[model samples]
Target: MEHSKIISAAMKINQLTDLNTYVIDNSGEFVFYHEDISIPAFMPGSGQEDVLNLYNQMMIQQMNQLYSYTNEWGLHYLGYSFSTNDSFAVIIGPFMYLTPDMYGLSREYNLRNNESEDLRSMCNQIQVLKTDKANSFASILQQFELLINKEAVPIRIVANKDNEKYRKRENNSIMNDDADIVTMRYKLEGNIMHAVEQGDKTTAIKLLNSNDMLFSFSERFPNQPLRRVKNLAIVLSTLLRNAVIRSDVPAIFVHRVSEKYAYEIEYSNQLSKLQQLYEGMVEEYTDLVIANTLTHYSKVTQKVIEYLISFYDKQIDKNELAELCFTHPSHLSRKFKQETNMTITGYQQMIRMNQAKHLLKNENISIEEIAWLVGYEDASYFTRVFKKETGYTPSQYRENN
Candidate 1:
């Protein structure tokens, strides 16, 4: 099989599914890749990628050989045999984690790194999760990869040209003026963000609809006009997520909606579907700003809400939240209840239970595991809370849905 066919198929499937897709050559080069910036960036602050790259090179060095591998960091790889006599393999994914088996990831590891600015930069890009929760989501990602590999389709890969042709094209591409394209991309991003910040839905929608220049896609497959639109949708969704955050929408609300639209954009294989989501996402954030009267609530209450949504998985203290919000615990508590018509603990429980519903629907973990994932230490207590909210135990919800 031509390697480009596999890469294009992986990219299409990635757009349809909520997973990052990558194809590594036998020499461990990232020849093709698609990763959403919406997914939190994470990497060990050392030579982790270099070490893993060496392992991949070693595994696929021999022709007709294959390997299924995982490491201390959250990478699950399946090396597929691609050549009969030549040593070529297609390695897919740097998945989250699988089976919650961290292999002592939390413990100190062996990789060495100089404490330099590069190391600090790597650490800043990293985001860590609890052992149990990371494992759950990682397993889900593994399953997605399995389905993609099984049903991987053929895509019309644009063929690379000979050296003479390639050099001529490269020279022409360099000479071509692309300043306009860059300006258009950035202008749309900035203009949409401004509308969202100002809560001006009219301006945002007008900008989205009027911009044939910004939203136009190139022809890929003859019948697939939306082919180029697919890639643009990823960038558009990312910009819209930032707009929603700047609009002062609750972080929890932003997280859920951003995730929803990301998947929606992925599976939108039709031009109309892509256009609908494109226009809707821009307007949606602007509408949130219009509706969210955050001034009605104190900044302390708003900060507390943001903090809880961000660190919902970890055990949190009331006093600590109050201190961070710069208010007396008692006064903040009263203000939170009066403004939101819900207590602080009550709101936190609501969000946790909502997330549990998501995990129950999407993951293959046990009820006990799900409880722990949503921050309930005692399974029995979690069941009680779940039953009270949804009239179904976690198992029943999983089974019924």
Candidate 2:
């Protein structure tokens, strides 16, 4: 078969499977690469040099064979070689056979110097497949090979015995030390709290999902799985609440979001639902810090900002806001402008515009409805304001985004 036809077929398979696919020519140069799922930048084999080195090694070994290789970090890949007047190989990979242990992966990849949160964030992005699914994908690739090259390829699993030996040795050493486990748990918790306080949602959620030693409840509870998970959720909510408080978000805002998740965690029965709630709790709390943290403002300005945030959809009365802050309207206005570099009405509009953008991105409502939702009675006026603020009209923004 022609190389172009083979590349075209591989692209189709990539679309169908949503996996990263690559085609290397006989000289170990990349003829084509399609990435439906990307490998994280921090991983060991994600670099071009490392990939080409591996490809060169594979090309020298054999042809007309399907190969499965699992790296020391537990990331898996599939490769197949065949001749088409010359040799070519199809590579699919960076998936996992099982959920990876972050600690073990860190040791294997010499990634301990990297932030644990970042490592976990990268780890969480990898896809995990069951044995059957892995086999099924392999079979599809094999069939593609047979169709394109007109030769059947035998599947080969390359065993990394050295990696296995190292993993067992490291696991035994780490598992036997109780102090290391305790230290890891505390360090993980502190890192997650730090991520939350900084409003780093990506890092927070990744840290929450990363550390198996800290987050695994089965070993702690053995039997009462639901109770164990709920307990962990409750603890996480309290931790996030404190972190938000430290970020200078109002106690009322933190309480409302924390209380909501606390109730949801207790009543939720499904593990999957609870897992989602865990991420949601991190997101909402981190957003609270992003939206409401007022550490830099005066107490009066802080109160006014909080009021505007809570009532952005309603009409603002300057006199009423001044009364609430125990000040005259002119003084209140001047103070707000001094602190925030925008007039009170301007700040309110900014909040409304932000809310409108959020709705535009996440909600499936009409433009007019969105205008009403963001406190604009006139859809045309809202469109003009949105266009001025974002350079793109709402419809265009939605389409472009």
State the C-alpha lDDT per candidate.
0.58, 0.74
Instruction: Work out the TM-score per prediction.
Output: 0.40, 0.47
lDDT of 2 by residue, 1-401 (tens): 67777877788768756778888888777777886454456675666543564566668887766676655566677777777688887878767755556555554555533344466665566666766888787777767665555667565645323347435544654333356556667767776777687566776887777664467746778788888888888888998899899888878898899879978997999877987788888899988996766767999998887787656777889999999999999999999999999999899898888778766865566888788666787999999999999898999988886
Give the C-alpha miss distance for residue 246 in model 1, angstroms. 21
| RMSD in Å for all candidates | 17.9, 17.3
Candidate 2, residue 250: Cα displacement in angstroms equals 8.1
What are the runs in model 1 whose C-alpha is more than 4 Å off? 1-296
Q: Residue pairs in steric clash, candidate 1?
A: 15-266
What is the RMSD of candidate 1? 17.9
- Local lDDT at 292 for model 2: 69
TM-score of 2: 0.47
